[model samples]
Target: MVYRHLNEKDRFYIEQRLSEGDSLRSIARALGFSPSTISREIKRHTPIDFKGLYCHRLTSRCAQEKRANAKQGQAFRQISEEAKMLIHQRLSTHTSDQATLFRTNKLQ
Candidate 1:
């Protein structure tokens, strides 16, 4: 099966199923994911103040915030203009040793 990230709808289903006291394995089977995935989702997203309640909105928000924060660390906005220019120059010239170039130039 093709791998895919769980969306808000899937999170909602998980919340509903969890509220109904469904087993992790059952929820996983219904969602076409592994039981470990379900378990991990619950473990990771269950808020400390919620005391183990699997809230879809809270979980989704936390997941979104996490993704946003992670992206901040990897954003193009973080790249220096000199590095960007170097990359453009290398690409324009069909150079393949970008890593070596970056290392030599102390850009990495």
Candidate 2:
């Protein structure tokens, strides 16, 4: 089976099923996911203060924020400021002989 991240629609469906007092296993079966997946989703998104209530809108917002923050953190970790400056400097200068050769050959 292919792995994929749950989207807003799936979260909303989960919310709807939960509201109808459906069991996690039943919801997971209908959604073609594992019961553990449904259980984890509920556990992760349901606020501690809200008791058992699960809001799809809030869950989606939280997921988006987490994804954005993770992406930003990964980008920073992959490239340092010094490396960025070096790349900028190289780009601002004339093309190197190797680059010119590659470009010329690609045109042929």
Which lDDT tens digits does candidate 2 get at residues 28-108?
999889999989888887789889799999988887887777766464465556655555565678768576445544544
Each candidate's number of clashing pairs is 0, 0
lDDT of 1 by residue, 31-75 (tens): 999999988888888888898888899999988887778766465
In terms of lDDT, the poorest run of 10 residues in model 1 is 99-108
Global lDDT of each candidate: 0.85, 0.80
What TM-score fits each model?
0.67, 0.64
Candidate 2 wrong stretches, greater than 4 Å: 75-108
* lDDT (Cα, 0-100) at 7 in candidate 1: 87
Q: Compute the lDDT of residue 65 as modeled in candidate 2.
A: 80
Q: Kindly report which residue stretches of model 1 are placed more than 4 angstroms away from their true locations once superposed.
A: 74-108
